[model samples]
Target chain A: MRRSALTSTLTFYLPLWAFLVLLLFPFYWMLVTAVRPNKELYNLSLNQLWTSHPTLQHFQKLLFATHFAPWLQNTMLIALGATVLALSCAVFAAYAVQRLRFRGSGVIGVAIFLSYLVPPVILFIPLARIINELGLWDRPAALILTYPTFLIPFATWLLMGYFKSIPVELEDCARIDGATRVQVLRHILLPLALPGILSALIFSFTLSWNEYLYALVFLSSTGSKTIPVGLATELITGDVFQWGPLMAGALLGSVPVALIYSFFVEHYVAGLTGALKE
Target chain B: MPSVQVTTAARVVRPAGLVGRVLENHHALGVMMVTPALLILAIFLAYPFGLGVWLSFTNATIGQAGRFVGLGNFRYLLGDSVFRVVVLNTTLYAAAAVVCKLVLGFLLALLVNREFRGKRIVRAIMLLPWIVPTSLSALVFYWIYDPTFSIITWALRRIGLLHGFINYLGDPNLARASLIAANIWRGIPFFAIGLLAGLQTVSPTLYEAAAIDGAGPWQKFWFVTWPVLLPLTVVVTVFSTIMTVGDFQLIWIITHGGPANATHLFGTLAYQRAIQGGFIGEGAAISAFVLPVLVGAVMVSFHYLRRE
Candidate 1:
């Protein structure tokens, strides 16, 4: 029985470990290429796993010699702006539905979520027109406006869950102390529910940063382009693909959020789980 | 002014605290708070949704108004060869990817659920792929599938698993599979983590009770875990289906629906038609095709995912 159990464990786990390695190897390979010297990278050596003389030259070129800086700046501006705007709007909407007994509240909640389910593909064409009519086409505000279509619904839903966890009695007691609704929200609810807000902000920021299709379609000028589209088109051209700098740019761009996850892993998980739950 | 008699009226007996007034009157404030959200939704979300349906009936192009050509685009799409293939591919891809994500994610969750040292770290690591940007990771895969120099191919050849070169992204069949594989890899994190959350909510005593009744591991899982997880699994499946069906980035970055239209899922196909091919009407029609399936999935899943 012991021997059979040992064999069963080996059969199940060993292959899974192998598969996991296979799954992760491409990402591992990317890091390898990012560090390897351009000369060594061209050689196709079996020992490409480790860099012989690892250098940060590729990263340097990405940062200094190319459009990487502008792209990074553009991404940061749009992402942060969108996150702040979306969260501000969503917090109020969420607070209303979760805490207050209002008319048509259920309908409002369901309507917001359904809007989130609407695919960007469904709305982009007409939305582009609306932006044009408003004289906002090719502008960053176009993205800001389009982003809340999905983000508000999600943020509202997410904040509602977090708000539910806050005890109502505390707010009631504070009410007896003569705190106005706005003051109570400012001093108590926002601080108490800060974790959920932060999570929502990060999610919204990363989403805007990573958005490709909208950036690709909407932004016309080189100055306005975000990182994903900007780098892909500029760095890669037919046969002479620029892997070293592209990977370097990618690595630098992703590191901030990756660090965010590593540091606040639990909140990140909680936020995601809560978001999905709704 | 003199007849009004400068009386203060005692300020109508103001509440003791600001909180008291707010607590007494939550509804009015709720309306005020929700107004901005409602207005934004009305302008950006609902209006555009209505516009989409309206535009489908018209021959609307980007930055230009075209005449209303009712049912014309749908007719053309019905006759288009590429659109047919896209519909087929999109359906197959969504079904296959969702199934693979569900099964693999469940298994991974089961494995990680076992007691082990550093389990929390493992769980966190498992979610890394999902947390990373999809386009960024897809770009990483693009390099891995490079024809001239690919680490994946090189490694496989070195291990004697592949003879010479493997153009994983260049070949049509292999290209679709490769995109699907990348998606499954990225998606497994969400599903596994979701299922793990569900698993934690199940009472351990139920499993212990089953064991006491002479039930084996499989029997315990079948009876207790499956029933408890069924609702969550359905919700995850629905979410995965919608996302996968609308997936464009992974395939777009990898193949651009290429090697002879083999990887043309609906989202990519729509972009290719409208943006690249300049068939605006046809693209809208193709995008509209997936709406029914998406709505159906949502309705069906809502039936199951709601609290009992």
Candidate 2:
């Protein structure tokens, strides 16, 4: 029994610990490097694992001395705008495809799923020209408008799965009672599918917030940049990497999504696996 | 009484006209409901996609829309040595990263599937790598792989494992390995969680039955667990493969296809040629080159999904 216990520790516990460290060490490093003093950060003699004195100086500089605030604002505005736009469209579309049972609904569902497979890399090049032609170059409206290309497909697909899970009888009964289609959706279907809607909303928000390539391609000016693009481009001038403030920006940039994930991780996972399962 | 009845009838008839009839029609309502999404997709996705294909046939630059030169851009790319390297690198990167992620992630799923203390917390913490913006995490990696002051180098030297600093991103081979490593790091969480969900669906009774048939752990897993997980595995693998192949942000941030253009995937190459270099036609061709592979993957998934 003792030998078996020892073997289990070696085989399972040790490896699990190692995987956790390997997976999470970067985040811990981000936190440590963000707070460590610049002198100690560069000092080879000092302990690099942890800081003797932690400071908020880097956060202050990241917020005050750079375009980080505007970037944050821009990311927030764009993410929220895209989420709202995508969710409203997805809710109605998902309801229609999953519940309305119109002709060609199955084909529409499959097409939407296939559209999710279309990666942004393939589309970004032509999208650049289109954005320019539309006079939305370097504008948040450009992303606000374009993000739905990816977002709506995914949101619609996911919400379709959710709508499938809700019983059709509820809506049928409500319709029999003289509920208009909109009234049925508003009262019966929407209430039961609240979890799914929340999942779609959170997923859309995070996906838009985390979107890098389009943001990188579409927005050029400093004032218009999102957090990812801004931190990547503006923080490092030439070869001199600002490790401190950059890490600070990364930490700050990740916090909102992290907070949202912590709260709604179950929904998030449901959204991810739910679509796949269906 | 006749006037009042006529007014009520008028009120009823007004709503039952064209607008109400349209609203009551399921087909019309479905079309109406799907229009906004379809409109957005048509303008942004479908239109641009077609335009992208058209652009590849031309020699269009950023400002000037050049006349169509059929097959010229593709012919030029086929001859280019750098383009060839990009094709090799992208394939290798996706294949290596997906294989590693699946193996490690399956083991992780197995480990986490067991009853352990603080399991919920561990699972949540495991997802952080995937949940965070990949660009930001890649920046952390960029810092970790710094030439002079890398923590990895410092730790290795202190432990007497090395004498000189290893330039993680300087050498061509090392840079490719580094990028793949970072990709695997970010991607493992997705696979682990996905496979964990699959693992949960397996019944403990099946394992017990396998054991009753005189099976060992490996046999039990092979006979019982593997079958259940296979479908989910195929699905997640296809999804990850597509994402990995089209991956741009991580490589772009880390190396920008540097060290003699060793790390340029199709996405980065397209960006370099089309956006940065302003050879819109060439870039479009480069980006569109991967369409066949993506379509093939989608077809396979569709087939599998249909069978399921």
Q: Put down candidate 2 lDDT per residue, A122-232, tens digits, no spaces.
A: 999999999999999999999999999999998998888888888888887776667778788899989988999999899899999999999999999999999999999
* Predicted structure 1: lDDT: 0.79
- In order, what fnat does every candidate score? 0.48, 0.76
Residue A152 shift from truth in candidate 1, angstroms: 1.3
Model 2, span B1-308: residue lDDT tens: 45543343222122476877888788999999999998999899998999999999999999999889999999999999999999999889999999999999999999999998999989888999999999999999999999899999999998899999999999999999999999999999999999998998999999888888999988988889999999899889998999999999999999999988888999999999999999999999999988988898998887888788
lDDT of 1 by residue, B1-308 (tens): 45756865443334667665655577878887888888888898789777767777778676466778989988888798887888888877887888999988988888777776677887787776776667778888888888768877777777889878888877877887888888898899889989988898789999999999999989998999999988888888887888888787788877889989889987788788776766665667777776887799779776875653
Interface RMSD of 1: 2.4
Best by DockQ: 2
The residue ranges of model 1 lying beyond 4 angstroms of the native Cα positions read: A1-16, B1-24
Q: Indicate the DockQ of the complex predicted as candidate 2.
A: 0.66
lDDT of 1 by residue, A110-144 (tens): 88877777777666666766877888777888888
Prediction-by-prediction clash tally: 9, 0
Among all windows of 10 consecutive residues in model 1 chain B, the one with the lowest summed lDDT is B7-16
Please give the distance, in angstroms, between residue A275's alpha carbon in candidate 1 and its true position after superposition: 2.9
Instruction: Indicate the worst ten consecutive residues by lDDT in candidate 1 chain A.
Output: A11-20
What docking class should model 2 receive?
medium
In candidate 2, position B27 carries an lDDT of 94
